[model samples]
Target: MSEQELKLHVPAVARRAVQQDIRQGNASRIRLRALYFDTPGRELARARIALRLRQEGRDWVQTLKMPGADAITRVEINHARPGPVLDLSVYAGTEVEAPLSAIKGELGLCYETDVQRLLRQVRSRHGTIELAYDTGVLRAGTLELPISELEFELMSGRPAAIFAVARRWQQRHGLVLDARSKSERGDALASLARELAALDADDPDAQVRRGTAITRFWAPRGAAAVTLDDTLTPAQAMGRVAAECLDQVARNAAVLAEVDTLGVYPAGQSEHVHQLRVGMRRLRSAWRLFDGWTAPPPATVLQGVRTHFAAFGQSRDQDVLNETVTPVLLQAGMPVITFEAPPVDIDAQAIAAGKAFQGWLLDALEWSLDVQPPSPASAPEPMAASDTAPEPAFRLDGSATAPAITPTIIPLATEAKPQPLHKLLGNRLHRWHAKVAAQGKDFATLDIPARHDLRKRGKRLRYGLSFAESLLPKSRLRGYRKLLSEVQDRLGEINDLAMAKDYYQACVGTHPQAWFALGWISARLDKLIAEAQQAFDRLADTKPFWK
Candidate 1:
C-alpha cells in the first residue's frame, strides 16, 4: 500500500521527553533490523528507489519504496518473507515493478540499520495517523552513525493530519524537518566508507586522518530551475513551482537548524540563511504572480510568512552593513561608528527551525497542492495594483517616458472549463513586465517606498521567468533574461545601501558620529542610484522577451 509519512528529527535534548511521552501512551514497541541493497553502480540509489529486507521481531518483511506524487507521499509495497532473505519477484505486478526489473547489475548489500521502534496510532480532527519513533544506528562496513527520528504514517486520514501532528511535536520538542530517507542517508554513509577504504589502499605512504575526514558534510541545497511541461493547467504549473520552493526552503532550514551541531557550512559561509530567505522570497513572488490565476493561500498564513520574511531581512541587512558595506566606508576615511541594535538580535537558527515558521510552510504547501478550481462568481481576483505596484513619481527627472499601461485582467477559470495554459502564462508575464518596466522609467525620481517596490516588482519578474521559461521561445528568453538579471542585481545593490542609509538616518540623533556615516552613505547612494537608473533605462529600448 502507498504510505504517506512525514519525518522529523528530534533534537538531542528532547529525546528523553519524547520517550516519556511515548511510554505514557498505549504503544507497541519492537526491534527492527533492516538491510538495504543496491546494484554496484548504485542505480537504485541514483533513481531514489530503495529495496530492503527488514526483520520485525521474529518475522521478516521485504519492502520497496520510491518517490510519490507529492513530497509527503511514497509508493511502498511489502510482502511477508519466510526468513531474512531479499525477494525481487515480490514486486512483479506492482507499480514499482518496471524500475526494479530494469536494473542490470546484481544487487548487493549496501548498508544496514538497527533501531528501537515505538509505534502508536492516534485519531485527530483530520484523520487517523500512525506515529513511529525510531532510535538506532545506521551501519555500513566499519562506519556507523546514530539515528533519531519520528515518522508519522497515515493510517486513514487526510495528508494534512500528519502535518498537524508534526507541527505539534515540532513546537513542543524543537524538531526540524528532515526529508532525507533512511536509505538516502545510508547510501551516503556507504559512499563515505568506500571512499575511506580506497584512500587507505591507494597509498600507504599518504597521510590521512580518518576521524577528521569522517565528519558529515551537510551540503547546501537549492531548487533547480525547471522547464515546465506545456500540457499542465495554470493550477498544476503553479503547484509545481510552489513545491520546488518548499523543497528548497525545507532542506535549507534543516541545515540552519543543525548548524549548532555541524559547526560550519561548506566554504565557511552563512549560505543557509541566504538560501532559506531566497526560497521564501521566490515562494512569495510566485504567490503574487499566481494570486488571481488560481486558489489563494490562507490570509493568516500569508501574514505569518511576511512577518518571518521581514525578520530574516533585518538579519541579512545587518550582515551586509557590517560585512560588506561598513568596511568600505571605514577604509574611505569614515571613523568607527557604533550603531543602535535592534530590539531583538535574531536567533537565526531558532527562527529557521521554529514551529511557527515551519507550520506556515506546511500549510502553504498543503494549499498549493490542494488548489481548487476557481469559483465562477467568487473566484480569487488579481491583487490590486497597490498590492504590488510602485507609486508613480510626481515629477520626472529624466526624459519623459511612455505612459504606464494598466495590467491585463485575466478571467477566472470556471468549473466547466479553465483558461488556456499558454494564454494564462502570457497574460500574467505581460502584466508583470508592464508594471516593472513602467516604474523603471522614473526610478531615479521615485521616493524610497516606490524604489523599494520597484525592486520587489523586478524580483517578481525575475522569479516568474524561471517558473514560466518553458512556454517562451528559448532565443527570446536568453537575451531577456540576461538584461533582467543585470537590472535586478543593480537594484539589489541600491537596496542594500538604502537600508544602510535608513539605519544611520535613525541613529544621527543619539550618536553624532552617525552623521559621518550618513554622509558616506548619501554620497554612495547617489552614484549607485544613477548607475541603476541608467541600467534600467537600457531595458526600455529592448523589446519585452515574452513578446
Candidate 2:
C-alpha cells in the first residue's frame, strides 16, 4: 500500500498506445507529459500527495482516466473538430494532508483506467498544439502557437516566457495562445448544480444525485433574476423614464443620472461619488442587454455618464491611493510610493474639483436631455427641436395626480421559463447532461477590466433573472433569488473595492511629485482592497452571468 505501488495500478495505456501507433504507418507523433497537482494553498504538495489525471484517446476509443483517489470520478469531453479542441475535467474528493512518508504509509494499491492518457489520445488525433505541457516544458504545436497552461497550481507562478513565445507564435503563425484554464465543462457542471437545486423539491429521481455531483449545496432565499423587455419604440426607450415600468431598470437609470449630476452638485463626498459610479455602471449594463427592444441610449448621454463617473472616480482614486496603493508600492520598494504629499489645502482643492465636475454632469443629464443644443464641432440636427420621445412608464405616471393604470409585466417568448428551485438541493443527473455545450473561448480574456466588465454584466443578468423569478411559483423561486442576491452582493463589494483602488492609484500618480507620502498611504490600503477584489473575483468566476 505504498505510493509507488498505487501509481502502478493504472495500466500503461498511454505508452502501449503510442507504441502501437508507431508500429502502424498512421502514427503522427509520440508525446509525454508529467503532471503535478496541488490544492489551492499548496496543501497537497506540503502533504506529499501525488495527484494527477492522465488522458489518451481517438475518435473510436473511449477515454482512459487515472484518479488520485481510488473512488474518484472524473468526467471528461473531447472535440474531434479542428483548431482549439476542448478537453475538460473536474476532481471531487476529500484530502489527506500528512507528510510524504505518512501519505505513502496510508496509500492503498488500487488500479483504475488512466485519465490523463486520453488527453494524449486527443492530442494524437489533433496533433499537438504548441501548448505549455504538464511538465512546465513548452512545446511548439502544429501551428506554433505559444500557450500559457496551468495545472491545479497551489501558488501563482510567473509565465512571462510562455506568454512571449505565444505572442510570437500568434504573430508569425495563424494560431493564438490562450491563458484561460478554467474549462467550460466545469462551468456547465456548476450551472447544472444551480439548476438541479431548483428541481429537487418535486423530482424524486433527482433527489439522489445532489451532494455526489454538485458538492457543498445551499438553498435559496428571496427575490431573484428580473428580465425587462423592449416594449416601447427605441426612441422612447432611449428617452427619459416614463410613467409605465417603474421597476429596477428605471430606478437604476434614475440613480445613475443623479450620480452623473453629482459632479455639478454643491457637495461631493468620496463615498457619494463612488456609490454614484457603481449605480451608473449597473444601469449601463442593464441598458446594454435590454436596449435591444427599447431604443438604445444616446451616445452623448452614455458618454456623459461615463465621463462624470470617471471624474468622481478620479477623486475617489486619489483617496484610495492615499489609503491603499501607496502602501503596497512602498512595501514593494516602488519609489513612486514615497512621493511628497500634496499641498495642505487638499480637501479644499478636492471640493473645488468635485464641484466643477458635478456641474458638467448636471448640465449633461438635465439640460442636455431636454434641449438638443448644437455642438461647436458639428451642426445641430435639422429636426433636433422636434425630437421628442415618450418617457419611461414610471416617470410618465408616478405622480399621485396622474391616472392609475394596471402593470403589464409579460415574459417574452424567447425567455426560457424554467421552474424555480425549492428549498432542498437535489440531484438531477440527467439535467447536468442536458446542458448545452458552450464554446470555451468565450471568456479567455482575463484582465482587470474584463473582470470588472463581467461583474457589471453578471449584475445585469442577475437582476433580469430576479425579475423573471417573481413570475414563477413563489414557493419554488424565492430562496434561489435570495442566493442570487447574496452572490450579487459579494460581486458588488469586489467591484467597488477595485474601482476605489484604481481611482486612488491614478490620483496619487496625478500628483506623485508633491504627494509621495500620500501614495505610500494608498499602497498600504491595497491589502484590504486586493483581498476584497480577490474574494469577489473568485465568486464571480464561479457564478458566471450565464448562470
Candidate 3:
C-alpha cells in the first residue's frame, strides 16, 4: 500500500503545557513507521510473526511490542507521518538487525476537530478482524475522553497488493476514510530508542530494565487547564467542566445516522449499540457515586438512556450472531440444521427487540447529550481528571496535618510460626471463591433481570478472588484464580448473549415482519448459549489453582 493510517484519540491532556520547550515543533504531533511481518508463516522471516520496528524523536514517547508468541500484528500510528525513516535506516538494529524498509506512502486526512470520527475507526477494526480480512478497513470513532480515534489498515497477502487493499479497505470501513499515513505506536517506540541510546546503563543487558524505569518514572502526567470565573482552583473544576462538555457533544451526536456504523459496521450497524448500554451502566455508577455530591441528572433523562441502551444492546447482539457468529460456526464445521428450536426462535425476537432498543438508545443518547445544565458553570466535578494528584495534605477542617496511613507489612516468622504467603492468599481466595460460587448457584433462582444482576455480582466476586491471588505468592490458589477468571469470562458471555436475545425477542414480537427476520437469527443464538456452556464445562475441568 502507498500509505497506511492510524488515528488515535488520546486524552486532551496529551498536549504539553505552555512552559515546556518545543525544539521539534510541538510534541502535539508525532511521527511513526514500521513493518508488519507474518512471523511463523515465512522462512526469510524466521523470527516468524515479528513486526520489525524503527522510529524517531524521544524514545520515551514511543511504545514497544510485547515480545511473545501471540504477537499477531505490530502497528505504528503516530501524530506525524514518516517520523522514523532516518532512525530506522541508520540507527536501528543489533547483531541480527531487524530494520524496517519504509514504503512510499503519504499521511492521510486529519480530522482536526472530530473526536467521534476517531473512535468509530477503532470499533470498525475490531468487528472486521472477526470477519477475516477481506480487503476492508475498520473504523472506530467517538467524542469522549481520552479522545476518540479511527484507524484504516490495508491488509494484503502481497506487498504489492497494499494500494488495492487500502482503497477497498476505506470503502468497506467508511467513505470519508483519510489516506493519511500515521503510526499509532511508532512515536512511542522511537522515543524509547532515543532514551536507550543516551542511557548510562552500566550493563548492556539491562537496557530493558532502564527503559521501563525511565518510562514509568518520567511518563508525562496529562492535565487540563481550566480558569474558573470564581476563586475555585483549576483542580477543583477542570474535570467536571471537561466531562460536561463531552457529555453535551456526545448526546447531540447519539441519534446515530442510518449511515453511521457502530461495532460491526455496515452489515451490523447497530453493534456499538452496547456503548449506550454500557453508558447506562456508567451513568448508574455516576448516580450511585455522585448523586449525594451533586444532584443527579433528571430521572427521566437517566431512564430514557437506560431503557434505550438496554434495548439496542439486545438488537445489536442478535445482529452480530446472525451476521457474524452463525456464519463462523457454520464455517467451523457445525451443522446449521441440527440445532434448531425454542432458543433459536427466542433469540430472533431478541434481534427485533434490539432494533427497537436501538431506536430508544438514539433518543437516550440525544437526551443525555442535549441535557441543559442548571447553569453554564454548575456541572459536577470531574473526578478522574484530578484523582491522580497526590492526596491533598490538609484536614477537612482546613488544618494541615499529617494523617498517618499504615503500610501493609509482611512480617517474617520463624519455622515455629512460619506463615506461607501462599497460605494467606489461599485463605482469602477460599473466602472469595466460596462467595462467588454461592452467588453463581444463587443466580439460578432469580428472575430474568434479577438472575442477570446476580450473575454480575457473582462475576465481580470472581474477579475479586482472582485479584487476591495476584497479590499473593504462586500457589494452588493461583491456579484456581485462573480457572475462576476463565469460567467467569465464559459464563459472562453466555449470560450476556442470552439476556440480549431474550430482550430482543420481546421487543421484536411487536413488529411481525421484523419478528420473522429475527427468528432466523434466533436460531444462531441457541448455538451460542451451548458454546458458552461448553466453555464453562472446559473451565470446570481444570482443578482450581488453590491448595
Candidate 4:
C-alpha cells in the first residue's frame, strides 16, 4: 500500500495542548515496541529500505517501507503473525525479495523504539485524517533520545486539506515540520552513537553531552554545475536558471536553520534572516523571468514560500526597530513611547518556517528536474519592447563609450530547435537595461509609484544579470553589479524613510511622543529624494555588462 502522510515535531511541553485539541471522541491508546534491523554497514538504510518488527497486543507485525514516487508518499508492506520472528518468505515475489534475501543473514537489530501511540480519526472539510501521537524513547545501546511527534495520515482527502490542517496547527502552536521518519532518525542516532563510542575509546575521560546540542559547522549543498556550450538551447538555459535558483533557496534555508539551532547572535543581529529573504526574492525573480519556459510550481508551494518570507521579514523589521531606529531616536533625545513589538521567539519561528520552505524547495527541485525541454515550435514568444529605440552608447559622466566587444548573436537553426542561450540572454538583458534607463530618465519628476516601479525594474535587471553572471565578462560584470547596488541602496533608503515616517505618523496621534521622530524624518525626505535621483542617473549612465 502507498501511504501519504505529514509528520510534525511537537515539543514535549506542548504535548498536552495538542492532545487536548484532538480529544473530542473516544481514542484508542496502545503500546508499540518496534525493533529495526540492518546490516553492519547499514546496506538497507543506504538503499532507502526500512525493516521493522512491532508488537501490538498479542500480535506482531513486520513492516517494510521504501521511498515512493514523491517525498510525502511511501510504499509500505506489512506482515502480521501471532509471534515475532524473521520472515523472508513473505517477500518471495515482491521488489524487496532480491535485496532482503541477499542481506538477510547479515541483518541484526540496530535500534528500538518504545512508544505509547494514540490513534484517532478527525474529519475535515475534504475528508478524514488519521491522527497519531507517539511519545517515548528511541534507544540505541546506551544512547536514548525522546520522540514526541504528531503524524497526520491522509485516509481519504486531497493532499491540500492535510497541508491546510498542518498550517493551522503550526500557526496556533510552534510545531516544526520534520520529514525524517522514525527509522531515519534512528539510523542517524545509531551512527552518532558509534562515532561517540569511537571517541570515548580514544579518550576514556572525554566528556559527551546529550540532547540537542548546537551544531558548530554546517556546509550546505551547492547547485549543480552548469557549463554552457555552443549547443546549449534557450530552453536548456531556462532549466539551468531554475535549477540554480532552487539550489540557492535550499542552501540559504539550511544556513537559516543552522543559525536558529545554534542561537548565535549578538543582541539583535539577524544576518541569516536577511540573506534568506534575499534568496527568496532572487528565486521569485528567476521564476518571473522564465515563467512560460516550463510548468510552474504548485500554487501552495509558492504561497508557502511567501508566507515564510513574510514571517522572516516581520522578525527582521522588529530587529531593525530595536537595534537601529530605537537607538537613533534615543540619541536624538526623542521619547519613543508606545513602541510595542510582538513577544516572539524569532529564532524558533524562523527555524520552523525555514524547514517548511526548504521542504517546498526540495519538491520544486524534483519537479524541475522532471520537466522535459520544450521544442522550438513551442518556444516562448519574444518579449515586447517600447517603440522608442534605446541610446546607442552609455556615458559615465559627459563622455559616451561603446561596448568594447559586442556579443555574438546566434540565429535559430530551425523551428525544431530552440534559439541559442547566449542570444536569448543577451536580448533579455538589453531589454531590461533599456527599461531601467528610460524609467530613470525622469527620476526626479516621477511620482512615488513610478519610482518604485523603476526600483523593481532595476532589481529585476540585477537579479537577471546575477543568474547569467557566468556568461558575462568578469571585469564588466563587477562594475555593472556595483553600480546597480548603489542605485538600489539609495532607492531603498528613500523607501525606508517614507515607511518610517508613515509608521511614526500613525503612532504619534495615539502616543504624541513620536511627533519628534516624524518631524525629523520629514525634514530629510527631500534630501533623500535628491540623492536617489543622482544614484539613478549614475545607473542610467552605466552600460549593460552583457554587451
Candidate 5:
C-alpha cells in the first residue's frame, strides 16, 4: 500500500500546546519502540529503504518503506509480526522482494526510536486524515537524540487535504515542514557513532569520553543537484525538473523554518536561506524553459514563490557582506565599521513556514507531477500563398510520395501534437545563447541595475544549459561552461561590492568610518567590470554546445 503524509516539526515550546489540541479529538496514546535495521555496508539506507519492527504497545508490526511515484508518496508495506523476529519469507514474491534480495551483508539493528504517539483519525471535506504526534528519543549506542514531530497522513481522498491541515497546524502550533524521516535521521546517527568509535578506539578513557559526549542533531541540508533522463517526453521532463527543484526548496526551507531537534538553529542559517532562494530561482528558470509546452502551476503560485524569495533577500545581503566581503575589506587596511540589524525586523523563520508559501509549495508539487504522456506525431501546417515562393505542403522525411502539392492530398490537423522535445530544446538554447551574447556586448556601459539584471540573466542561462547537459554531449559543453563560470564569478564579486557600497554609504552620516570602506569598494568596481566584460565577450563568442 502507498501512504501520503505531510510531516512537520513542532517547536520545543509548543509541544505541550500541540498535545493539548490533539486531546480535543479524543486521541489514543500509544508507546512505540522501533528498531531500524540496515546492512553493515548500509545498503538499505543507500537505497532509501527502511526495514523495521515497531512495537505499538503490545503488538509487533514489521514494515518496509520505499519511495513512490511522486515526492509526497511512499510505498509502505506492513505485516503483523508474531514476535520480535523479522521474517523475510513473508515478503517473498512481493513487489519489494527484489530490492530486499539485493542486500549482500547481514542485517543488524543500527539505532532505536522510543516515541510516545498520540494519534487520532479526523474526517474532513477533503479526506480521512490521521493526526500523529510523536515525542521521543532516538538512541544509538550511548548517544541519544530528541524527536518531536506531527504527521498528517491521508487515509482517503485527495492529498491536498494533508497540506490544508498542515497549514492550520503550522500556523497554530508554529510547526515547520520537516523532510527527514526517523529512518534517515537514525541512519545518520548510527553512521556518526561508528565514525566516532573508530576515532577513539586507541585512546584511553574512550568509554568515559563517549558517555559524557552529547549527540547534536543537525537538520538535513539538501543539495541543489539535478539529473534528467534523456528519453523523457517534454512534459515529463518539465514536471520532473520542477519537482526536483521544489524538493530542494522545501528541504532548505524546512531547515530555516525550525531549529534542530535540540532547539538550536544550525550554524549556517543564512546558507539555508541562500539555498532556498537558489532553489526558487532554478524553478523559475525551468518555468521559462518549459513555457507554453505544457500546463504550469497557477500564476498565484509563481508569485508566492517570488514573494517569499524576496522576503529572504535582505537577510542574504547582510550575510554576504558580513560573512563574505567584510574580511576582504578588513585585510585591505579598511577602517573599523560595524554592521548590524535591529533584532525585531529579521525573520527567516516566519517567511519560510508561512501559510501562503507552504500552501503554494503543496499546490506546486501537484502541478509538477500532473504531466500527461507523450502525444502522437504532429502534422505540418498547410503552406500559405504569398508573393514569395510557397514551400511544398509535405517534406520527404517521413512520408513517401507526399512531396508536392496535389488536389487529393489530405491535410492533417495542426492542434494536439506535441513537438519533438529535442528540436524545441535546441532552438530555445540557441535563442537564449544569442540573447545573452547580444546583451553582454556592452556590459560596462550598462547602469548598476542593468548590470544586476545581466548578472541574473547569466545565472538563468547557465542553469538552462546545465539542465540540457544530459540531453547533449558532455564533451561539447566543457569549454563554454568554464568561460561562463569565470564570468559568473567576476559578476558575483561586482554585485557583492555594489551591495557593500550601499550598506556603508547608508552609515556615512552617523559613522565617519563608513567613508573609507565606501571609497575602497568604489575604487574596485570599474576594474572588476572591465575584467567581467572581457569574460562575457569570450563566453558570447563560444559556440552553443547543443549544436
Candidate 6:
C-alpha cells in the first residue's frame, strides 16, 4: 500500500513542547523499539529498500518500505506476528522480492531505534491527519544519535491538510521540514562507522579524497529533486519552478554549511558562497514572478531571507575586492595604501544565516504546495494601457527626461483563467524585452543608479526565462541566455568599479592609501561605462527568443 506523510525535524529542546501540545488533544502515547536489517554489504539500502521489525506493546510487526513518487509518499508492506523473525514470504510479489530473496540469509541487524511516540488525529477542512511525534535515540553498535521528529500522515483526506497543520506548528514552534528517513540516517551512520574502522586498520599510505571528512556533517541528501513537467499548466509550472528553486537553495545551503565547517576555501575561491547566492537570487526571482498568484510567507520570513542574502553579499563583496579589484589596481601602476578584508568569522555568520534561510525556504515550499490556484472568475485583470508607456529616460545626474518611445502592451494572465503557460511566458518575456530595450536606448546617458536598475532588469529577465526554458526551443534559449549573461557581466563590472570608488572614498579618513586607488578606478570607470553601454545595446538589438 502507498502511505502519504510529511516528516519534520524537531529540535531536542522543542520535543517536549510538541509532545505537550499533542497531549492536550486526543493523543495516545506508545513506546516503540524498531530493529532495522540490512545485508552485510547493505544490498537493501543500495536498492532504497528498508526492512524493520518493530515492537509495539506486546506485538511484533515486520515492515518493509521504499520510496514512492516523492519524498512525502512511500510504498509500505507490513506483517504482524507473535515474534520478530525474518519473513521472506511477505515480499512475494513486490518489487523488493528479488532483492530480499537474494539477501535473505545475509540480512542482519544494522541499527535500532527506541522512540516514545505520541499519536493524534486532527480533523480539518481538507481532511483527517494523523500526527505522530517521536523522540528517542538511534543506535548502531556503540554509536548513538538523538532522534526527534513529527510526522503528519494523511489518514482520510486531501494532502493539503497535512501542510495546513504543519504550517500552524511551524508558525508556533519553528519546526523544520526534513526529508530523511530513519533507515537512511541509520545506514549512513553505520557506513561511516565502518569506514572509520577500516581507515584505522589500513596502511598509512592510503589516500583520502578531499572534503570527504565533512560529508557526514552536512544535511542528508533529500529525495530526488523536483523537475518541471512540460505538460503542466501555468500555475503548475510556477509551482514546479518554486520547488526547483527551493531544492537549489537547500542543496547549496548544505554545501555552504559543509564549507564553513571545514574552512577549506580561501578568499575568492568559495564556490559554495557563489552557488548559495545564485540559489537565493533564483528563489527571489521566482517569488517576484508569482508573488500575487501564490500565497507569500510572512513579511518577517521574507525579511529574514533578505538579511541572509545581504550577509553573504557582504562577504562576497570583500572577496572580490581583495582578489579581483586589488590586482587590477596594482597592475595599473597604482599604489594601494590599504585594503581591508571582511572579518574572518564572515563565513561562519553566512552559514548560520543560510541555515535560517533554508528553514524559511522549506516552510515556504510547504505553504506553496497547499496554495489554491485562482479560478477564472477571481483572476486578476491585465495591465493597464497607460502602464505600457515607455519610462522616461534619465541623465547621468539621475534627472528624468521626456519619454521618447512607447512600449507595446503585454497582456498578463489573470487568476480567473490564466492563458496557456507558453503564451503567458512569451508575453512576460516580451514585457521584459520592452523594458530592457527602452532602458538601453540611452544607456550612455544613464547614471550609476539607472544602470544598476537596468542590470537588475536584465537579471530578472534572465531568471524568468529560465522558468520557461524547458518549454522553449533549446538552441534559441541558449543563445538568449548567453546574450543576457554578457550584458549582466558588463553591468556587473561597472557596478563593481562604482562600488570600489565608493569604498575608496569611505576609506580616505582611515587609510592613507585610498588616493591612488581612487584615481585608478576613476580612470577605469569611463571605459567600463562604455563597455556596459555597448553590451546593453547588443542585448537590445538581439531578437527576443519568445518571438
Candidate No. with top TM-score:
5
**Weakest ten-residue segment in model 2 by summed lDDT:** 2-11
Residue 80 of candidate 2: its Cα lDDT?
A: 35
Report every candidate's CA lDDT: 0.79, 0.34, 0.36, 0.70, 0.80, 0.72
Misplaced by over 4 Å in model 2 are: 1-267, 321-339, 342-449, 462-547
Lowest-lDDT window of 10 residues in candidate 4? 209-218
Runs in model 4 deviating more than 4 A are: 101-105, 201-290, 293-547
Q: Could you tell me every candidate's TM-score relative to the true structure?
A: 0.79, 0.28, 0.30, 0.53, 0.83, 0.66
Residue-level lDDT tens digits of model 6 in 1-547: 9998887766544667888899999899899999999987998999899989999977899999998754467999889967988787877987777877777547889999999999999888999899999888998877676777889899988877877777777556656555568998899877766665566436554445213642544433332333454366645666667666665555555444432223443222355566656767877877776655556655755786688777777667666777688888888776656444455857632353233654565556665455445543565787897976676799999999988975669799665765566766777778888899789878889877888888888888888887767667788778777877887887888788788888889988888678888887877787877876777777778887675
lDDT of 1 by residue, 366-479 (tens): 676676655557757888867867545444666555556668786996666655666677678888888887889899999989988898888888888888888788898898
Residue 193, candidate 2: Cα error in Å is: 54
Q: Compared to the true structure, candidate 5 yields what TM-score?
A: 0.83
Q: Per-residue alpha-carbon lDDT of model 4 for 109-174, expressed as tens digits? A: 999999988888877897778889888889987777678788888899876556656666655655
**Candidate 5 lDDT:** 0.80
Clashes of each: 0, 87, 71, 0, 0, 7
TM-score of model 3 vs. true structure? 0.30
Clashing residue pairs in candidate 5 (N, C-alpha, C atoms within 3 angstroms): none
Clashing pairs in 4: none
Measured over all alpha carbons after superposition, the RMSD of each candidate to the real structure, in angstroms, is: 12.6, 30.4, 21.1, 15.2, 8.4, 12.6
